[model samples]
Target: MQELAEVRLTAWVHGHVQGVGFRWWTRSRALELGLTGYAANKPDGRVEVVAQGPRAACEKLLELLQSGNTPGRVDNVVAEFSEPGDALSGFVER
Candidate 1:
């Protein structure tokens, strides 16, 4: 079996994303899904993350973000491709 090459995604999670441990949850989930990146609380009450991993893993992560099960509004998710970075061994909260 061939390993899937990793891709990077920058996601801006909107709506009541702060004060709800969203970043932590996202990081944990991402790690479990074999993703590499960091999630953080934005100043405008949003969560921002840069995730890099297999294409399927990245897609799954996006699906999770859009699922609206993180104890927040998750009004919208703005994502785009980005250059891969030296992400942590596991997902992290930043």
Candidate 2:
């Protein structure tokens, strides 16, 4: 079978995302998808999610981020796609 291409997704989630378990929820989703990266709280009240894995898995994570089923209210999600650079292990919430 052909292997799926590895990719990285960096998403900035805005709107009532912090202080509401958003990072923890993101970590859970990332782990479920077998992805490796981190979900961090930004100083601007947004949550930044970085996930690296198969392209399809990364896309799924991005879709879930914008599905409005997360912990907090997500007004918008801005995502960027790129080639994976750093080797990551388990997902983390920061």
Best-fitting candidate, measured by lDDT? 2
Superposed Cα deviation of residue 53, candidate 2 (Å): 0.3
Clashes of each: 0, 0
lDDT over C-alpha atoms for residue 68 of model 1? 82
lDDT of 2: 0.92
Residue 64's lDDT within candidate 2 is 94
RMSD of each: 2.0, 1.5
Query: In model 1, which range of ten residues has the least summed lDDT?
Result: 1-10
Runs of candidate 2 with Cα error greater than 4 angstroms are 1-3
Error of 1 at 92 (Å): 1.1
The TM-score leader among the candidates is: 2
Lowest lDDT sum, 10 consecutive residues, model 2, at 1-10
For candidate 1, the per-residue lDDT at 54 reads 84
Q: Write the per-residue lDDT of candidate 2 for residues 1-94, one digit (tens) a residue.
A: 2238999999999999998989999999999999999999999998999999998899999999999999879999999989998899899988
